[model samples]
Target: MTIPKSVFVVDLNYVVTLPEIDAHIPGHVEFLDQCYEAGLFLASGAKIPRTGGVIIASAPSRESLEAHLAQDPFHINGVAEYKITEFQAKKHKPNFFD
Candidate 1:
């Protein structure tokens, strides 16, 4: 069997008005683009009812992930709070990590 890899599920909850969150979307997306380019993020999208967002990511350690997330515009602006959960991916698509 292969060893499982650590993955993080980041849940973002809006703490401010929708307009406030919207104002940061461009910067937030730019951040996401950078993460994706760095192969740190797997997937991300906004939640239904437009509450907040979620991101699936992988990193060497939780500390590293936290550091990266700290750069997010929402985090910087205090418009959203993040709750991150880490889990081991014991089973996933054949090329999920490729």
Candidate 2:
């Protein structure tokens, strides 16, 4: 059986500019792909209302989680920023993984 994990929630405000547009989107996509390959960011996408980004990631600790996110190109290129917040979620169903 798999052990329970800590799922972190990341909220990105937004970036409005040509440099940010060119750097942020592609960078985020590349980072997301890497996360998928690494098995850390289970799921990630843009937020509702088109504000910014939302990522659901699993890590050992908040610092580790931030480090993982820091690898994202958007962050490295100074085109984007993130607010990492811890979350406590409850789920119950016949098929939780479904």
Candidate 3:
């Protein structure tokens, strides 16, 4: 089946030190779980340099995506800033489109 929603790449850049990020990890993880359950997030993980993280998601519109991202604990506590990029998925492995 084809999904009509737009794909987004959420880049989280940490503004504070590692301790602050650590302090909010629990809430941040909870937020991620909520996003997953809501079908907003497809995948996510920390950066190799430990600076921040990235999230692959989909939304009906940019406005809606920003609204949902605003609810993240990292955003709430100003621990990180988000840069959202929208893109088209032109290719994938077998069954990826299902």
Please list the residue runs of candidate 1 whose C-alpha ends up more than 4 Å from where it truly belongs after superposition. 1-4
Give the least accurate 10-residue stretch of model 3, judged by summed lDDT. Answer: 89-98
How close to the true structure is residue 22 of candidate 2, measured as C-alpha lDDT? 61
- Displacement of residue 92 (Cα, Å) in model 1 is 0.4
Summarize candidate 1's per-residue lDDT along 8-89 as a digit string, tens digits.
9999999999998999999999999999999899999999988999999989899999999999999999999999999999
For model 2, which pairs clash? none
Across 1-98, the per-residue lDDT of candidate 2 in tens digits comes to: 34335667888767666555565676678779987787777667776776677887767788888888778777776666688877654553443322
How do all the candidates rank in terms of lDDT, highest first?
A: 1, 3, 2
In candidate 3 the C-alpha lDDT for residue 31 amounts to 92
State TM-scores per candidate.
0.94, 0.76, 0.92
The 0-to-1 C-alpha lDDT of every candidate, in the order given, reads: 0.92, 0.71, 0.89
Give candidate 2's TM-score: 0.76
User: TM-score: which is higher, 1 or 2?
Assistant: 1
How far in Å is the alpha carbon of 39 misplaced in model 1? 0.4
lDDT of 3 by residue, 42-88 (tens): 88999989999999988899999999999999999999999999988
Q: Which candidate is the best by TM-score?
A: 1
